[model samples]
Target: MNKKYHDVFSRLDQKDKDLLREYSVKNTTGVIFDMLKIFEEHQEFKFIYEEDGKQVNLVEISEMLKAEPLSEYGWIARFSKHVKDHEII
Candidate 1:
Protein backbone atom coordinates (compact mmCIF):
# COMPACT_ATOMS: atom_id res chain seq x y z
CA MET A 1 0.00 0.00 0.00
CA ASN A 2 1.18 3.52 -0.67
CA LYS A 3 2.16 5.61 2.32
CA LYS A 4 -0.52 8.19 1.61
CA TYR A 5 -3.19 5.52 1.43
CA HIS A 6 -1.96 3.91 4.62
CA ASP A 7 -2.21 7.26 6.34
CA VAL A 8 -5.69 7.82 5.03
CA PHE A 9 -6.87 4.30 5.87
CA SER A 10 -5.70 4.66 9.44
CA ARG A 11 -8.48 7.15 10.08
CA LEU A 12 -11.64 5.26 9.10
CA ASP A 13 -14.40 4.56 11.60
CA GLN A 14 -15.73 1.04 12.01
CA LYS A 15 -18.84 1.63 9.92
CA ASP A 16 -16.98 3.09 6.95
CA LYS A 17 -14.34 0.41 7.20
CA ASP A 18 -16.98 -2.29 7.05
CA LEU A 19 -18.58 -0.65 4.03
CA LEU A 20 -15.23 -0.43 2.24
CA ARG A 21 -14.46 -4.06 2.95
CA GLU A 22 -17.86 -5.10 1.74
CA TYR A 23 -17.52 -3.04 -1.41
CA SER A 24 -14.12 -4.55 -2.14
CA VAL A 25 -15.42 -8.06 -1.65
CA LYS A 26 -18.44 -7.52 -3.84
CA ASN A 27 -16.33 -5.88 -6.59
CA THR A 28 -18.76 -3.00 -6.37
CA THR A 29 -16.84 0.18 -6.99
CA GLY A 30 -19.28 2.93 -7.66
CA VAL A 31 -19.63 5.98 -5.44
CA ILE A 32 -16.50 5.40 -3.43
CA PHE A 33 -14.44 4.71 -6.51
CA ASP A 34 -15.87 7.75 -8.18
CA MET A 35 -14.81 9.90 -5.27
CA LEU A 36 -11.41 8.29 -5.16
CA LYS A 37 -10.88 8.66 -8.86
CA ILE A 38 -11.66 12.32 -8.66
CA PHE A 39 -9.07 12.79 -5.97
CA GLU A 40 -6.62 10.61 -7.86
CA GLU A 41 -6.91 12.71 -10.95
CA HIS A 42 -5.97 15.82 -9.02
CA GLN A 43 -3.70 14.35 -6.40
CA GLU A 44 -2.54 10.80 -5.74
CA PHE A 45 -4.57 7.80 -4.64
CA LYS A 46 -4.01 4.28 -3.41
CA PHE A 47 -5.79 1.36 -1.78
CA ILE A 48 -4.62 -0.52 1.25
CA TYR A 49 -6.10 -3.79 2.51
CA GLU A 50 -4.95 -5.39 5.71
CA GLU A 51 -6.11 -8.77 6.94
CA ASP A 52 -6.19 -8.01 10.67
CA GLY A 53 -6.57 -4.26 10.72
CA LYS A 54 -8.75 -1.45 9.46
CA GLN A 55 -7.66 -0.19 6.05
CA VAL A 56 -9.32 3.13 5.24
CA ASN A 57 -10.35 6.41 6.77
CA LEU A 58 -13.77 7.99 6.55
CA VAL A 59 -12.54 11.39 7.65
CA GLU A 60 -9.89 11.45 4.99
CA ILE A 61 -12.39 10.35 2.42
CA SER A 62 -14.68 13.11 3.56
CA GLU A 63 -11.90 15.62 3.35
CA MET A 64 -10.98 14.50 -0.12
CA LEU A 65 -14.55 14.90 -1.29
CA LYS A 66 -14.82 18.23 0.38
CA ALA A 67 -11.81 19.40 -1.54
CA GLU A 68 -13.15 18.30 -4.87
CA PRO A 69 -15.36 20.17 -7.32
CA LEU A 70 -18.37 17.89 -7.04
CA SER A 71 -21.58 19.81 -6.93
CA GLU A 72 -24.03 18.74 -4.25
CA TYR A 73 -26.91 18.09 -6.59
CA GLY A 74 -24.79 16.54 -9.30
CA TRP A 75 -23.10 14.15 -6.91
CA ILE A 76 -26.35 13.05 -5.41
CA ALA A 77 -27.91 12.61 -8.82
CA ARG A 78 -24.98 10.60 -10.10
CA PHE A 79 -24.87 8.42 -7.03
CA SER A 80 -28.59 7.84 -7.14
CA LYS A 81 -28.44 6.96 -10.79
CA HIS A 82 -25.56 4.54 -10.21
CA VAL A 83 -27.48 2.80 -7.44
CA LYS A 84 -30.58 2.60 -9.55
CA ASP A 85 -28.66 1.16 -12.47
CA HIS A 86 -26.92 -1.37 -10.26
CA GLU A 87 -30.22 -2.45 -8.71
CA ILE A 88 -31.64 -3.15 -12.13
CA ILE A 89 -28.94 -5.70 -12.82
Candidate 2:
Protein backbone atom coordinates (compact mmCIF):
# COMPACT_ATOMS: atom_id res chain seq x y z
CA MET A 1 0.00 0.00 0.00
CA ASN A 2 1.44 3.33 -1.07
CA LYS A 3 1.19 6.45 1.01
CA LYS A 4 -0.66 8.17 -1.85
CA TYR A 5 -3.57 5.68 -1.65
CA HIS A 6 -3.57 5.36 2.13
CA ASP A 7 -6.22 8.06 2.53
CA VAL A 8 -8.40 6.45 -0.11
CA PHE A 9 -8.39 3.15 1.75
CA SER A 10 -8.72 4.77 5.14
CA ARG A 11 -11.80 6.72 4.11
CA LEU A 12 -13.87 3.61 3.57
CA ASP A 13 -16.61 3.08 6.17
CA GLN A 14 -16.66 -0.11 8.19
CA LYS A 15 -19.51 -1.48 6.09
CA ASP A 16 -17.67 -0.77 2.92
CA LYS A 17 -14.46 -2.27 4.29
CA ASP A 18 -16.30 -5.37 5.43
CA LEU A 19 -17.95 -5.78 2.04
CA LEU A 20 -14.67 -5.35 0.23
CA ARG A 21 -12.90 -7.76 2.54
CA GLU A 22 -15.63 -10.38 2.13
CA TYR A 23 -15.60 -9.99 -1.65
CA SER A 24 -11.82 -10.15 -1.85
CA VAL A 25 -11.79 -13.43 0.07
CA LYS A 26 -14.95 -15.08 -1.27
CA ASN A 27 -15.48 -13.85 -4.82
CA THR A 28 -11.88 -13.84 -6.01
CA THR A 29 -11.87 -17.56 -6.76
CA GLY A 30 -15.25 -17.41 -8.51
CA VAL A 31 -14.10 -14.64 -10.86
CA ILE A 32 -11.87 -17.00 -12.82
CA PHE A 33 -14.51 -19.68 -13.16
CA ASP A 34 -17.14 -17.12 -14.14
CA MET A 35 -14.88 -15.72 -16.85
CA LEU A 36 -14.13 -19.22 -18.07
CA LYS A 37 -17.82 -20.09 -18.22
CA ILE A 38 -18.58 -16.92 -20.14
CA PHE A 39 -15.79 -17.68 -22.59
CA GLU A 40 -16.97 -21.27 -22.94
CA GLU A 41 -20.36 -19.98 -23.99
CA HIS A 42 -18.75 -17.52 -26.42
CA GLN A 43 -16.48 -20.26 -27.81
CA GLU A 44 -13.33 -18.24 -27.31
CA PHE A 45 -10.45 -17.62 -24.94
CA LYS A 46 -8.72 -14.29 -24.54
CA PHE A 47 -5.00 -14.48 -23.86
CA ILE A 48 -1.72 -12.81 -24.59
CA TYR A 49 0.28 -14.01 -27.55
CA GLU A 50 3.59 -13.14 -29.12
CA GLU A 51 3.69 -11.90 -32.68
CA ASP A 52 6.67 -10.46 -34.53
CA GLY A 53 8.60 -10.54 -31.25
CA LYS A 54 6.04 -8.35 -29.46
CA GLN A 55 3.55 -9.61 -26.89
CA VAL A 56 0.02 -8.88 -28.00
CA ASN A 57 -2.32 -9.01 -25.03
CA LEU A 58 -6.07 -9.68 -24.72
CA VAL A 59 -6.02 -11.46 -28.06
CA GLU A 60 -9.22 -13.42 -28.56
CA ILE A 61 -8.76 -16.92 -29.95
CA SER A 62 -11.20 -19.71 -30.64
CA GLU A 63 -10.68 -22.99 -28.83
CA MET A 64 -12.23 -26.41 -28.47
CA LEU A 65 -11.90 -28.90 -25.65
CA LYS A 66 -9.93 -32.03 -26.48
CA ALA A 67 -12.05 -35.08 -27.02
CA GLU A 68 -10.65 -37.01 -24.08
CA PRO A 69 -11.77 -36.41 -20.50
CA LEU A 70 -9.50 -34.15 -18.49
CA SER A 71 -8.37 -37.08 -16.35
CA GLU A 72 -7.41 -38.98 -19.47
CA TYR A 73 -5.87 -35.87 -21.04
CA GLY A 74 -4.10 -35.02 -17.80
CA TRP A 75 -5.54 -31.46 -17.85
CA ILE A 76 -2.91 -30.15 -20.25
CA ALA A 77 -3.08 -26.72 -21.77
CA ARG A 78 -1.30 -25.72 -24.95
CA PHE A 79 0.08 -22.59 -23.34
CA SER A 80 -0.14 -20.61 -20.15
CA LYS A 81 -0.46 -16.90 -19.47
CA HIS A 82 1.88 -14.94 -17.24
CA VAL A 83 1.14 -11.46 -15.99
CA LYS A 84 4.43 -9.62 -16.34
CA ASP A 85 3.76 -7.27 -13.43
CA HIS A 86 2.41 -10.00 -11.13
CA GLU A 87 5.20 -12.50 -11.77
CA ILE A 88 7.02 -11.80 -8.48
CA ILE A 89 3.94 -11.69 -6.27
Candidate 3:
Protein backbone atom coordinates (compact mmCIF):
# COMPACT_ATOMS: atom_id res chain seq x y z
CA MET A 1 0.00 0.00 0.00
CA ASN A 2 1.67 3.15 -1.23
CA LYS A 3 1.06 6.47 0.51
CA LYS A 4 1.24 8.46 -2.67
CA TYR A 5 -1.63 10.79 -3.40
CA HIS A 6 -2.36 9.01 -6.68
CA ASP A 7 -2.77 5.74 -4.87
CA VAL A 8 -5.23 7.24 -2.44
CA PHE A 9 -7.19 8.92 -5.21
CA SER A 10 -7.34 5.66 -7.08
CA ARG A 11 -9.00 4.00 -4.14
CA LEU A 12 -11.65 6.69 -3.70
CA ASP A 13 -15.18 5.64 -4.61
CA GLN A 14 -18.13 7.83 -5.56
CA LYS A 15 -19.08 8.21 -1.92
CA ASP A 16 -15.60 9.27 -1.08
CA LYS A 17 -15.57 11.70 -3.96
CA ASP A 18 -18.90 13.13 -2.86
CA LEU A 19 -17.59 13.58 0.65
CA LEU A 20 -14.64 15.49 -0.70
CA ARG A 21 -16.96 17.56 -2.87
CA GLU A 22 -19.22 18.47 0.05
CA TYR A 23 -16.17 19.94 1.76
CA SER A 24 -15.08 21.77 -1.39
CA VAL A 25 -11.97 19.64 -1.38
CA LYS A 26 -9.99 19.44 -4.56
CA ASN A 27 -8.65 16.18 -5.91
CA THR A 28 -5.57 17.79 -7.35
CA THR A 29 -2.34 16.18 -6.32
CA GLY A 30 -0.95 19.37 -4.84
CA VAL A 31 -4.02 19.96 -2.69
CA ILE A 32 -4.05 16.42 -1.42
CA PHE A 33 -0.34 16.69 -0.74
CA ASP A 34 -0.87 19.85 1.30
CA MET A 35 -3.71 18.25 3.19
CA LEU A 36 -1.51 15.30 4.04
CA LYS A 37 1.18 17.73 5.12
CA ILE A 38 -1.24 19.49 7.42
CA PHE A 39 -2.26 16.15 8.88
CA GLU A 40 1.38 15.26 9.47
CA GLU A 41 2.11 18.57 11.16
CA HIS A 42 -0.95 18.63 13.38
CA GLN A 43 -1.82 15.70 15.57
CA GLU A 44 -5.37 16.94 16.08
CA PHE A 45 -6.08 17.61 12.44
CA LYS A 46 -8.77 15.29 11.12
CA PHE A 47 -11.14 15.29 8.17
CA ILE A 48 -14.21 13.46 9.32
CA TYR A 49 -17.60 12.56 7.83
CA GLU A 50 -20.64 11.08 9.52
CA GLU A 51 -22.14 8.11 7.72
CA ASP A 52 -24.46 5.51 9.21
CA GLY A 53 -24.32 7.63 12.35
CA LYS A 54 -20.61 6.91 12.66
CA GLN A 55 -17.53 8.98 12.06
CA VAL A 56 -15.34 8.09 9.12
CA ASN A 57 -11.85 9.53 9.25
CA LEU A 58 -10.06 10.17 5.96
CA VAL A 59 -6.70 11.30 7.18
CA GLU A 60 -5.53 9.47 10.26
CA ILE A 61 -5.55 5.99 8.75
CA SER A 62 -6.80 4.51 5.49
CA GLU A 63 -6.89 0.74 5.76
CA MET A 64 -8.90 0.98 8.96
CA LEU A 65 -11.64 3.22 7.60
CA LYS A 66 -14.89 1.97 6.07
CA ALA A 67 -18.60 2.79 5.60
CA GLU A 68 -20.47 0.27 7.65
CA PRO A 69 -23.74 -0.10 9.47
CA LEU A 70 -24.06 1.57 12.84
CA SER A 71 -24.15 -0.52 15.97
CA GLU A 72 -23.65 -0.25 19.71
CA TYR A 73 -20.49 -2.33 19.49
CA GLY A 74 -19.58 -2.79 15.86
CA TRP A 75 -16.58 -1.34 14.12
CA ILE A 76 -17.48 2.05 15.58
CA ALA A 77 -16.51 0.65 18.96
CA ARG A 78 -13.00 0.50 17.60
CA PHE A 79 -13.43 3.77 15.74
CA SER A 80 -13.13 1.92 12.47
CA LYS A 81 -15.61 1.38 9.64
CA HIS A 82 -16.43 -1.91 7.95
CA VAL A 83 -17.76 -2.87 4.50
CA LYS A 84 -20.78 -4.80 5.72
CA ASP A 85 -23.73 -2.45 5.99
CA HIS A 86 -26.46 -5.07 6.40
CA GLU A 87 -25.18 -7.49 9.03
CA ILE A 88 -26.41 -7.18 12.57
CA ILE A 89 -23.60 -6.22 14.85
Highest lDDT model number: 1
Which lDDT value does model 2 have at 48?
A: 54
Off by over 4 Å in 3: 1-27, 63-89
Candidate 2: residue 73 Cα off by (Å): 28
Better of 1 and 2 by lDDT: 1
| Residue lDDT tens for model 2, 1-89 | 79877888699987887677667634643565455555456645645567889875332433432221122232222233424342321
Score every model by TM-score: 0.30, 0.31, 0.32
Regions more than 4 Å wrong, model 2: 32-89
Q: Which residue pairs overlap in candidate 2's backbone?
A: none
Give a tens-digit lDDT track for model 3, residues 1-89.
35697788678987886676545523343354555566656768776778889996665654322222123453444665433542222
Encode model 1's per-residue lDDT on 22-49: one tens digit a residue: 6763454355556666655654555444
* Model 1, backbone clash pairs (residues 3+ apart or across chains), number: 2
Off by over 4 Å in 1: 28-89
TM match of model 1 to true structure: 0.30
Q: Give the candidate order by descending lDDT.
A: 1, 3, 2
Model 3 scores worst on lDDT over the 10 consecutive residues at: 63-72
Could you tell me which residue pairs clash in candidate 1?
A: 9-56, 12-57
Better of 2 and 3 by TM-score: 3
Task: Tell me the whole-model lDDT of each prediction, alpha carbons only.
Answer: 0.55, 0.49, 0.53
Model 3, C-alpha of 22: deviation from truth (Å): 26
* TM-score leader: 3
